[model samples]
Target chain A: MARKLYELAHSRAGDKGDVLMLSLIPYEEEMYEKLREQVTADRVKSHLNHIVKGDVIRYEMPNISALQFVCQGALLGGVTTSLGMDTHGKTLSYALLEMEVDL
Target chain B: MLRIGSGAGFSGDRIEPAIELAEKGKLDYLVLECLAERTIALAQKRKKADVMLGYDPLLEKRIRSLLPALLKNNVRLVTNMGAANPIGGAQKIIEIAEELGLKVKVAAVTGDDVLPYVFENADSLLFNPELFETASILSANAYMGVSEIVPALETGADVIITGRVADPSLFLAPMIHHFGWSVDDYDLMAKGTVIGHLLECAGQLTGGYFADPKKKDVNGLAYLGFPLAEVQSDGSALLTKVPGTGGTLTLRTVKEQLLYEVMDPSSYITPDVVADFTTVSLREDREDRILLTGGRGKERPAQLKVSVGYDAGFIGEGEITYAGENAYGRAELAGAIVKERISRNYDEFKVDYIGAISGHRGSFGHQVNPYEVRLRVAGKTFEEDKAQRIGEEVEALYTNGPAGGGGARKFVNEVIGIVSTMVPRTVINAAIKVMEVGQNGKETV
Candidate 1:
């Protein structure tokens, strides 16, 4: 169920060129394999066509659990674009938390 | 006489005396020690409660009054009050200074709070599985050395705020910055590092933790007045206390501070140097002052040590005791029975029986006599349910033993499980980005 949810969210996120970085607390190698099986680079690239251009996607597995995703270029012209307003970054962080990942 | 000032970790203590001595008595720098392990945890909780406004408000309130006075007197301030949030602490200081209308350039050295970043890139960051398993890290605070703070000093920062930096770094940074010492200059940096180690604990260098020879008048010593360091451009430093301060600066006090957290006296690694503590020498310089000199250091390591955390398994423990005529035998039998019961019920459980008993010396000056014994059984089960089951079995041991009717029944059961999966470890990795921005215009150190 978690894997399916992660795949759907990841695919949706990938359509917009935003890379998903997954970190598992007390990192387990099995999680990396599970993620690889759930989502592919091509599928993520296809999703990116719906969002923004020049977005870099990255997947990271830190020694800790809990995944992290960096959505570069997705917030272009957003509040963080000026660096004066931190709202855009906060919003994106909140949105990322809302993303569902399949176990 | 060389004048110096030091600050302690508790609250309600004022920095006024330290300030007066620094300004009026011509002291070189003032050192304040704040952050502790528990304090960091508290600050983290408070920060989480209000992310927009970081840290407890009291630190800012007290520091606001001291900033203007310290800046006016030209007494440099170094402290670890930055806790887990140095950047936020720096911003707060900047805000407070701006509010007071004081143009104090504040320099904050970060890269210490790498918990968020490490969590962001855990899988790609860690290579070892065992590193993740054994460590149940709650907080991974990067222990930054002092070299980074030098740039802030060069940038003309009157007040420098930093996160979980080594206690010695606060003192070493000012020496490095003021003397323009090179990183590879092991001898000079080692001398500064020694000065830092001496003054890091504030009152500890004075009579606070010292063993007085007379043992008289030691009880009247106050906690507020701490020791200070007067560092020269020549890379030498002197330790002294403020005038009218209650503490005494003896060779005993200085020696105690030197040996505080040091694991190895010969090779004490600091941000400045791998110092040789064995070569250090000290002498009393008049009343309330001690001269510290002669510390040799080696080159610093290339990488910074980062703390990382991961998950570990759950654990539970329970203890029960038995007492009666054959207390020793009964205790032993009771332990065996309990273990047997647990083994029968649960496949995965660890049990340990620890205690001492006095038995009869059959043929000696004493006739056959029994002694009392206390048996403590502790075990851990992976499953919480299984732990509870084991707890029930241990509790029932008291009523079902050979000495059941008269045996003592005091059992404690604690269930332990992985509530969350996060353990912290220190990893020494390659350098990231190095940019030196100081008053002299950004130059790479």
Candidate 2:
């Protein structure tokens, strides 16, 4: 079945330097492996191509059933220099959560 | 077991919750994490104008409001509220205690200020050394660890003030000092660091900012309880908040916070240790209580991360609102006209349709335009007058260009921010000073 990532998981956004770190956790603990297989760096990179300027790195946490994506060059110039109203990219997590995931 | 209560999460956090924690939480230590990356830089700018006024703006109110209860309940404090001036902040706290006729001891940790070292080694910054040469650096501070702060707490000081220490170290130091934990114990340090991270945001773990409607509804949000950690001698912790307080403590909330600002699950770097959260596990023992275990750590990083704040020109921002039919078109036209007016004066300017694609352009798809939208234009310039022109141009759109532009708002800000760099550990020389009242009820440092 195809469903929005938000319906399957919950995520939060944080920033450091010019990178936007988004943590994605499945709503049900049993779906951890499914996310590990589907939410690859390439998949996420393709998902947020317009939002991110550089490469994306994904770190997996099997025990916690969470995945963290560090999207580089995603904040324009980051908190200090970015002219965008969403300076810290606090809402970028929603863009990732809006992606369609197959379960 | 040690009960560590989180008081204030940031510089402007609510004060009343902290008092409640001190008076009723039955805590052994109270830790407040208030300093952010650019906070000290702004405080330094204020200190440049007047020497005695560079600490946290809410320092007096936070301390004065909580002093009576804190002293009465025998709760000790550890904080980085000394934004740009630890000595001045310490002196101010002591003076406050004296005015209330309460005996108290104060301690200040020093040597995080690396402004001189930065100027000397700007060209040799470990990463991106080139940025420092051209950056008009304002303040450079190194993140200190438990090394200096732990000793200061050993002096039995009622309160400790510090500059830029890692947020987690505020909660971890007292644990290290009280439990006599080995400084080289990586596993324990990692566990403590994780607890610190959870409590550092204070109310976030206790539901200050995590309430979502329908999906994750939280109860009694207005009186949300702050977080506290009941840490064991074996480096495990149970995270919870006060009883009958608003906000829910659940596995969902803890998981979200665990990864907050963390780069890698295997190597989360801090001055004290490289905390690895890869195999960490958590389970709810009961309602509003989560038990955390299995944190691992590696050797500490040799170079400490330094946050260098510098002047970054000025930001001029202006906004205007349009409503009813064709509002999006009118707002777009208003944005274009303002851009045309200010483009000549500014080298670069950005126009964002606040209510439209400014935030969610990607996922929102190509739907019909919003009935009403806000148009905002922001520009950066070296000259204040030129920065002023961006807003002035936007304000002119109401009478001169747009038909129904209302609620026009504008502002100009002197932008200053922190740039990250790493310096060798040998260069940092952190110190600590403890003060107490003598036999005559006079304070001594």
Candidate 3:
């Protein structure tokens, strides 16, 4: 399902100069803790290498819950095609909602 | 007493409509209210982000077009569209007047946006530490009284733009300033405030929101007519709308608007007067006008009230319907099963049972018989995910329940977080000052 969503978003943007940020939350709390032990920031960065181009890939772990992946500059034509707005302000909100990862 | 006019909710052509009516109808004062509560909140958010440019940059363009007509018609304008950027609003109006070669003095009334003041004094004022935690402080506006506006008018500003003056005070100020109506003249000022309230929403009283079904059918009703208050020196006023407009002005419509948006009907307080609505009487006049007579006003309150919001915990709820021999009993059983499942997963959870059909049995006026029941279960937890899980469990009840036929149908769930904050009440202690400038001087009124 995650790969399908990625493919759909990629097809919509024509996959040129687009960056994809994938945010995932493991089903169980212990599963995330185990994944944390196995995956370092560099390994996660390498895993996301296919999606990252010129922009940076950032990871954030909110204290309450959830791990968020932020991909920049990968969106084709930036925000105009992504969120239908020409501003960086409105596009940021659309990008956050688009990268949904369900565990 | 100063004679001031106050009204709200205006758009397009700025003061031309008011000035035209004032000139053609020979009105003594004109007040326009353009800021809604939500507009103030949005403006405050912009100000906090340091993007406060001016109150609607388009306002000056509209005002520029209307100045010549306003000056020729001798209509003094007061409005609360200034939002959090009154200074910016004033400067733009001044620039327009200069460009048009109209010597109009513009005075801006400030100190209404209280976000900075509240933040500075939060430590001493707020009782709870959590009150200052979250940033939901969209806007902080002061409900200024008539006393503040009279002085700015006295300063001889032909156009006065304010932040968040109370809706009625705009009308009352011109009356109190021109007529010398005493603060204790509650009966007279109350009449003025009532007049202001009726005319506040423009066409609202004049058939815009009238209860008459025919008003809904009236053609060209979309371009609502603005209100006009004809005040007498004795404190009696006539409320009417712009001429040749497609709307009704009736006592019933005026009374309905008087009761709308107000918390207490008896003590409807403005800056200059605390009006007792019970004393007001509305009479339909010859034209599309309502004569407001005998409103009892009283001393203004000491402290001005402010509204604030804070962060609260998250909540989620789901509902399902049960129809069977023992529908109510089965609904209760379904709630218990969901509670048990949620408790096994999380230790801290708040659960509530809401029954929608419990009152229907008594209100239907028929012999009570077996009927279907709708049960709603809502749970609140610190963790948002746990709240979502509770919603999932409630949805699963249709397949898993006692009798294998709880008949749980049409399940719906929603999750929402609460924001808790208090609006600290304060007093506008500044004394009223009225300064007069000559008509030929830089300031022209």
Candidate 4:
């Protein structure tokens, strides 16, 4: 079944310069493997293509059942120069959660 | 076990939660981690304008409100609220102590500023050449380590203030001081570094950023409690908050904070050690306590990271609202008019339908014919006069049709851009000075 990523996981976003770092952690321990196999860097890059202008790199943390994505060219110019209302891109996590994943 | 409580996460954090921690948390040390990346740079600009005014603006108010509780509980304080001026900040604390009829000792740590070194070596430094060539440099500060802070803690001072130090270093100093851990001990350094990173954001581990309606709910958010760590000699700690407070301290909250802002899971670099978070383990102790242990570490870096702040330009922003039937269409019209009018003078511009397209850039799709919407137009320009035109055109929409435009507002802000470079550790020096005040209002240096 096709389901929203938010139904199975929760995420948080942090920023440094023009790069955006987002962490994805599953709600259940058993779901970690499914998220790892299904949610790849290319999938996320294509999903948020409208928002992120550059490449996305994913790092795995099996001990904590979490994944971290470092997306470049994400913030328009960064906090000091970005014209967006949420200059820090704190809302980018919710936007990542809005993606649809095959479950 | 040594108990340490987080007073304030940033410069302008809530005051009452810190007071609650001081009054009831039974803490041995209270560390307030302020000073963001560009904060010291902004403070340096102010110091250039006037010598004694570069410290945190709320230092007096914060010290005045928490002094009684801190003194009564016999808890020592450590902070980077000194910003660009640690000596000035330390003097202000002494003055406040005398006024409140209390005796206190304050230690100030200096030598984080490396502007002179940066200027001498700017040609060899690794940074954006274009920015370095055109922009005027404002400030450059190297992140100091626990080596300087431990001496201040050793002075037996009631309060310790510094200009720019690593956020995690603030928490690790007390652990190193109390436990007498050697800096070369990488295992202990990693464990202490993880604990510091988890608690550095203050209320974050206690549910400040972990609330969602109908999905993951948190109770009593109005009186959210800040976090404290109970550390043992073996480099293990219990993360919890004061009882009867408004937040939760479960394994879930701890796990969320464990990876917050962390780029690499295995290697998180600080001035003291390169911490490995993958080895850490967490378990729920009781209702509101979580036991944390086992974060490994490697050797420290030979070079220090420096934050460089410079003038970018100005941001001119304007917003106006349109309501009552076909609001989206009318808002779009207003956005087009402003963009067309200002495109000649401004090269870079941003137009957003605030209620619908601002945050996600219309990725989530828009509402079906919303009753009201706000239109925002902004531009980047070097001249303040040119920036002012963006808002002027937005406000002119009142009489120029697009119908029902109201609540027009505009702003122009000077922007400061930040970049980073590396400097050899030996290029910087750390110094500490202590100031004391007596009960009779007599000041001694």
Specify the highest-DockQ model's number. Answer: 2
**Per-residue alpha-carbon lDDT of model 1 for B1-445, expressed as tens digits?**
2233566433334555555555555655666667643445456555777763434345686577677667777777777777756666766776676667666666666656666655666665555534455444344556677655666666666667766666677777776666676768888778877777777666666666443244313533754366777777656667776667667776545654565545355677754578877677777788777777777888875545443433223333445654556666776687788777776544334443333422100112223234555554444434557646655666676567656423333333322111112223244221222232334443322
Pairs that collide in candidate 4 are: none
Worst 10 residues of 3 chain B by lDDT: B411-420
Docking class of 2: medium
CAPRI rating of model 4: medium
The TM-score obtained by model 1 is: 0.55
Reference-based TM-score, model 2: 0.97
Per-residue CA lDDT of model 3 for B397-440, tens digit only, reads: 86786543343333222211112223334533333222223344
TM for every model, in the order presented, reads: 0.55, 0.97, 0.56, 0.97
Question: What does the lDDT read for residue B12 in candidate 3?
Answer: 36
Q: Which stretches of candidate 1 lie over 4 Å from their true place?
A: A1-103, B1-4, B9-25, B37-45, B53-58, B98-101, B116-138, B211-219, B309-445
**Candidate 1 vs candidate 4: which has greater TM-score?**
4
Question: Candidate 3 on A1-103: residue-level lDDT in tens?
Answer: 2321221211111121133433333333344454444334454444434333454433333221233344454442232222111212222222322332323
Badly placed stretches (over 4 Å) of model 4 are B365-369, B440-445
C-alpha lDDT of all candidate models, in order: 0.52, 0.86, 0.54, 0.87
Model 4's TM-score against the true structure: 0.97
Candidate 4 lDDT, B1-445, residue by residue in tens: 9999998888889889889999999999998888888788889888889998788878999999998899889999989999999998999998898889888999999988998998888878846757756567889899998988999999999999998888999999999999999999998999999999999999888988888877767888899999999999999999999999898887767777888878787899999999999899888879889999898999999999998888877889889998888898999999988877777687579998877768877655435566788998998888988888888888999998598999999899887888888999998888998999885565555
**Chain A vs. native, model 4, TM-score:** 0.97
